[model samples]
Every structure is written in C-alpha cells, then in structure tokens.
Target: MRLLVINPNTSRGVTNRIREAADAMALPGDRFTTLCPAYGPELIVTEQDAALARQAVVDTVRGFKGPCDGIVLASFGNTGADPVRALRPSIPVVGIASAAFATARALGGPFGIVTFGKGLVPGLQAKVDEAGLSDALLGISCVAGEEFGDPGEVQTRFRSELEALCADMHQRGARSIVMGGGPLAGMARSLAPTCPIPIIDGTQAAISLIRAVAAPRGDHEPRRAAAPAET
Candidate 1:
C-alpha cells in the first residue's frame, strides 16, 4: 500500500523526523511518502497555528496528484484530519492522536500523554474526549522549552525531562503513555526502553494503524463458477 504522511507544519526538521518514524514502522511492500506544507508555522503551539496548519493540509492534499491508498496526519494534535477526510472520502485517514489513543486503549488501561507544552494539553484532552476514551486517559504532562531542531540534539536535551514526566505518569497510575508531537518521534524511540509502561510514539502509531486498516483482508472467497449451469 502507498501511504501519504502529512506533517501540517512547515518545519522541515519535524517533517524529517516524521518520515524517519514512518519509514521505520512501514511493513514490507508498503511505501510511504511524507510531506509538509510549504507555508505554515514552524510548530503548531496555539489554536491559531493549528488552524493555519489545518488549512494548509487541506490545500496540500487537494493538490497532490499521486496515488495514495491511505493518509496519515502526522501530528499529535491531528490537525486537518477531519477536513481532509471529508474532502477525500475514498482515501483512509489516520491521525496520530487517535491512533496513539487507540493503541493505548488496546494496551488495556488508563494512559497519559506527554506533550511539549501546557498549551497543547487541553487540545489533546479534547481529542481524548472526541475518541470517547476520556475514561481511559490518566492525564497529560508537559515538557516545555523543547526545541524541534536536530532530532539528536532535541532527544538529548529533553531526555531527562521526558523521563521525569513518564515517571510521574506511571506514579499517577498510567498504564501506558503516549509521547505526543511528530517532532518528538526520535525521543519516543529513545525513551521507550526505559519506560516502565508502554510508550507510544504517535507518529509510529499512526503509521501502524493506517497500514493495518489499509491491508487487504482474505476473509471472503470468490464464488465458484455457478456449477456450469447444472452439469
């Protein structure tokens, strides 16, 4: 299957991180094309930023001409997913927030989200409510001042902060944790091993979920030729 991963933000750095995570999660025979709008905020931290990114996503997807079996909105905020899905009903759309939350629910308990800033907490909470998973959500924790530049540097700089947040979530009875933000994909991979509970990277979860939904099913078989008109 061919998947299109859209990072609504304009930051090439964040887009690259999303692409790396998608590529790592892609199954054999699956192809992923990752893109970002040429115009939008470098990072979507506020409502206005998200709004702009949403419009940009719609424009970008509408203009895209290549084959896309599925689309992954590669942002923890799930920017423009609904609009794009409405615009292209035939194509499957998966958003990182929804996918990660679903994966957390499947893991069987209350989950917490670790995001970049407090400003995003309410938005993420709203998504949990929208998914009808509010009961499964433990809470949200923020790690402020994390930069979206060089993945390696970002991961290194925020490692301690993320670890602390995860520890707090686990202490607060969270059975699983979602590391929100597409730019934080590398950090999620790095921190997962040490985390006591499952650490779901939203980008990776989005990729996996989309692929599962898009994969061909073999439950039905073709009917045999109608008995040759009664031999």
Candidate 2:
C-alpha cells in the first residue's frame, strides 16, 4: 500500500525524521511518501503554531498529486486531518495522535504522553479531549529543559530523559506511554525494552492503523445480483 505522510511543520529535519521512522516500519510491499509544508513554523509547540500548521497542511495536501491508498498526519496533534479527509474521502486518513490514543485504548488502560515541549501539553490535552479519550489519559510529561535546537536529534538527545519519563508514568499507573511529537517518532522501539509499560509511537501507530483500515475485506465487496439486501 502507498501511504502519504504529511508533516505540518516546514522543518526539513523533522520531515526527514518522520520519513526515516515510517520507512523503518515499512513492510516489503508497503510504501510511505513523506513531505513537509512549504511554509509554516519550524516546530509546533502551541495552539498558535498549530493554527498556522493547519493551513500549511491543507495547502500541501491540495498541491500533492501522488497516488496513495491512505494518508497519515505525522504531527502528534493530528493537525489538518479533518480537512484532508474532506479533501479525499475515498482514501483512509489517520492522525498520529488518534492512532496512538486508539492503540492505548485497545491496550485496556490509561495512557500517558511524553513530549518535547511543555508548551505542547495544553494542545495535546485538547487533542485528547477532542478524541473523547480524556478519561483514558493519565497525564503528560515534558523533557526537563528548553526545546531542542534540532527536532530530528531529539531521540538521541533525550533518550535517557524520555526513558525516565516513561518509567515514571508506568509507576504512576499508566499502562502505556505515547511518545508525542513527530521528532520522537521511532524512539519508542529503542526504549521499549527498558520501559516497564508499553511505549506507543504515534508514527508507527498511524502506519499500522492505516494499513489495517485500508486493507481490503472480502465482505465489503458488492454482492452478486441474486444476493439479498440487508434489512
């Protein structure tokens, strides 16, 4: 399957991070095409940044004429997902955060989020509320320091800190922890061994869910002429 992954932010580094992470999870026949907006904030940390990213995402989707079976919004907050779905109703569109939350819910317990910026906490909470999974969310934790210089380097820069946060969340009763932000896409796989609870990565979750959602089911095929209609 071909999946279109869009990063609302304009930072090429972050876009590259998303691409590498998605590529790492690609199956033999699966393909992921990742891109960033032509113009927008380098990184999204607040509602204001998201506001701009929403437009950037819409414009990028509008301009891309590639073939895809599904769309994955790489931003943790799932920026511009609604509009993209409206733009391409025939294809499946999955947001990273929505995918993460769904995975956490399916895991059967509350989940926590670990992100790079404290400023992102409110927006992430808003996303949780929007998903109607506020009850399932335990809490959100941020790395102990200012935002990083390069988003692509976050996984390496804060590996230990992120693992500690994951451990803390597990101790606090969280059954799983979501590694928030596009920059931290593939970090969970590396940290999972040490983390007491499950670590959900939004990027990986989005891809996995999209593949499932887009996969063809025999039951969904149109019935033959003699088949009876549903009551």
- Prediction RMSDs, each to the true structure: 9.1, 8.1
Instruction: Summarize candidate 2's per-residue lDDT along 1-231 as a digit string, tens digits.
Output: 677888888878778777877888776555567888888898988778889999989998898775678889999778998889999899889889999988988997889999887777888899889889899889999987775778878888888888888999999999999988888888888888998788998988988888877963233334332111110
Candidate 1 TM-score, true structure as reference: 0.85
Residue pairs that clash (backbone atoms under 3 angstroms), model 2: none
Clashing pairs in 1: none
lDDT of the candidates, in the order given = 0.78, 0.83
Q: How would you encode candidate 1's per-residue C-alpha lDDT over 1-231 as one tens digit per residue?
A: 667888887877778777777777765555578888878887787899999999999998987876677888988788898899999798689888888888998998888988766666778888889989988888888877644455324556677887999989999999999987777775677787777888998888877776667754333434232111000
lDDT of predicted model 1 = 0.78
Q: Please state the error at residue 1 of candidate 1 in Å.
A: 1.7
Give the C-alpha miss distance for residue 153 in model 1, angstroms: 5.5
Error of 1 at 226 (Å): 42
The clash numbers for all candidates, in the given order, read 0, 0
